[model samples]
Target: MHRTWAIIGGGNGGQAMAGHLALLGERVRLFDVFSDTVNAISRQGGIKVTGAVNGFGPLEFATTDMGQAMEGADVVMIVLPSIYHEEMGRNCIEHLRDGQIVFLHPEASCGALAFKKLLVEAGNTADVTIGAANTLLYSTRIITPGTVDIFGVKHSLYMAALPASRGTRLEEAIGSVFPNFTLCPNVLYTSISNNNAMMHPAPTLLNVARIEAGQDYFYYTEGITPSIGAFVEQMDDERIALGEAYGFIMKTLRKSYFDMYNSGDMSESDSLSALCKKVVAYREIKAQKTLRTRYVLEDVPYSLVALQSLAKIAGVSTPCIDAVVQLAHGMLHGELDEGRTCEALGIAGMTKADLLRYVS
Candidate 1:
């Protein structure tokens, strides 16, 4: 029954979500740490969402003020990349209230645990329930300063809360806003389900030459050749192995790619190169202009590193994951280690059984 929403991020997903929520007749406040985006949206008279979801929804409160953004809000949404999750939690922890619900749009690897760590470190004992979506509700891009192009909206998504006991309550509250959400067993269920980590890093990393050359080509179609697909398959094996260790099975990389752009039925080409030819949304998504993009910078650290570290807890070997990290370290000259770690996430020294009990 709570309708007041505070969306934290000015990225495409955040703007699109604000519009969709407003279309549902809910009151929304949007917060971005970036002042320029806040000022731009404010000066433009609100956000304009186009493509998949279209509308102009005025953010009731838009500011850099964490206090102003979070005050009186029923749900505070994290809509940015996982790289910002820790900082966001740290920034907003002081103002988080007892009944507030903080939702991570797409739970990247161990995101719920990392954000919750920030809260606990800040001494927050508020009855705040932390939850995360398995995948972003929308495939979107900010077309302009205050305009966003939404390509797709996920029909159904899984979400879960830490401490599992709060899952049903959070589910019912969010179900009012997005009726298709299904409550998952725990945060790792959603974290392991992240498709972006499986999809982004390899293709982008393998195509560094094209990206650095500022080449404009369809990333999936041209970049992820059958050869590169082999690397992705190897990486996926490492990821799936860790998940299997915990009695969890994640979608195969091929199935995930098909689900995003084609009929999700397992009838398509299993070859990643052949499968990329089927993606429609990625037709114009050119390679990054530099090796510094999140495909390498963020995912290698936050996504792959978190997974590999957790794999250690389960006594799982992630040689493929380590290979990518080693290669990225060579390319980036060592900013790679700064991403999320189970230790930094406060899950260090935990065994597989210990982690299950802790996250659950």
Candidate 2:
């Protein structure tokens, strides 16, 4: 019996997951909010992918209707942004049955915990398992509405569960499909492990003028020279310090990038420089001429802002993180932290003891 996998969002990430599962002969269902995107995918036969992975073919299923897409799915991968996870979880509360596992990609800032809370709030407590991938497996792009180009899958992707008891079972479920998945100690590690909040926003926000000025640039490689990379490393160090103060083990941004790019056996310096090369190659292949990546739009509120709150509770000073957040706000025109903050996620106002009580 083949397990059915449902990937929501139907964007690059969703399409890539669906394509992989379908290719493996699993039943894969894809859904998105935009009808045009769905129509484009269906009309084009399937998503066309390039680089390390390649080929284009038909998907097992694709739909705009959420409930219909989730029917009979053994695993549901929420590939959408962190903001949508809560509502998606609520919707699943009514539809998801026992034995189904909902996996949040990257689980930005403990999003899995919030999603599970939403499910509980909906007055439904079926034995549906909740989990999250530490980071998105692929660094990809949607060349067209119907095509996805996968850069590579990260090594050492992490996962964890709510209530801390379902970790093993959820890991077993997701591991059956993605053998590379590793179980994290808890959601806190998985949540804060996202370096995009630290790395992406700094460069994108700092280089906003250049981005807006149409100065044809590739951010990580060309825009982030030695000095900029040094600043990024410093910000990453602050993030690690915050995690350490809370008594957690967080990987450096360099290691995270190396893991994502699969640059194994490479020295630390070699690994970071390799990552720079990957970023450059990515821009060239995609013909990207702007700095409007998801680092600021997706990473700031989801990852960095969340960490800032955590640092406050842990009594850690995150000067670099703070500066980047303020800089991102100044550049972006609005406070990304307005509605979604640690408090909004139920972590704010809680003492360090209270947080450790849950995480521990």
Candidate 3:
């Protein structure tokens, strides 16, 4: 059966997903806020992605009109900035119909819950299943207006659904698009497993002098030296502790790093030289910089902020994460505390007893 998939945010990730879904013969619709990008996709039919899979075909539709793109979509994949999820959710509440499934690719916090709040505020009670993840499935980018490059597609993409009652149906819906949907126990574990939240802000804040110093930086592996990696690992340890306190066995950031850059363990390559060799191989295979670059700017606010909330709930000290949060605030010239904190997201104010029942 030919299914319909709408990819929100017509940037690199959206385009890459649209390309793969189209390749699977799904009716793909791509949308973005930028009119020029929409026009470019419309004119060129679709983006041309290189590596792993290569093909070009006319997108079923390309538009800046959210209603038009979502009116009949069976599955809607959102890849926008985390800050924008509320606005997008509001829009979706106004337009989403019954039986449609909305997927937040790498939901930072409880995006499904936030989105559900929007739906309730809109007085909509439609049975629209919402699913979210801790991280995206691929590292990809658009080199130009209509060209996308996928560096790597993850082996497993973890996800959880709102209400916890809709997880099975949500999994089945997304599995239609990508067969690698691994059902997480819930959103908390998925959120904790996100490595970017811990790694991104620390390095970006630490390397601000360099990033602002006008030197061209490479991938994250470039900035993550021994000492920096240790700092990042410390933050990751705090996150793991928070997860354990909350009763979720979250994966360690070091293990996730090994999966991404090495062989999933330092013991596999005990020396810095061996790790460097693995990093070189990672760079040589593919070099798309959208998600890799946004990890700091984007993940810090959403993911790190959530980590801080979890840490507070668990009574775990997160000095490193706190420092990075402050540093990110200075770098962005805005207080992330306003929108990135638990209280800001309408969750921190809840007591532990309340949170357990809520997320549960």
Index of the highest-lDDT prediction: 1
Clashing pairs in 1: none
> Could you tell me every candidate's TM-score relative to the true structure?
0.93, 0.86, 0.88
Residues 116-174, model 2: lDDT tens digits: 66775677777877788777888787888877788887656778776567787776677
Residue 128, candidate 2: C-alpha displacement in angstroms: 2.3
- Superposed model 1: Cα runs more than 4 Å off: 43-45, 213-215, 263-269
Q: Please list all clashing residue pairs in model 3, or write none if there are none.
A: none
Instruction: Write down the TM-score for model 2.
Output: 0.86
Model 1 C-alpha lDDT per residue in residues 24-92, reported as the tens digit of each score: 778888888789888988886678888877888776867888789889998989898888887787888
Model 2 lowest lDDT segment of ten: 280-289
Q: Rank the candidates by TM-score, best first.
A: 1, 3, 2
Q: List ranges where model 3 is wrong by over 4 Å.
A: 260-277, 281-296, 330-337
What lDDT does the true structure give each of the candidates? 0.81, 0.73, 0.73
* TM-score winner: 1
Model 3 lDDT per residue over 1-360, tens place: 677888898877788888878877889999888999999889988778777668885688899999899988998889877878887777767778898888898687666656766776789988888888777777897888778888778887688876567788776777656777788766667777776676566766676666666665553546666777777777878888878877877767555546656654455434332353356444443222332255555677677877777677667788888888777777666534344566555565676656666665
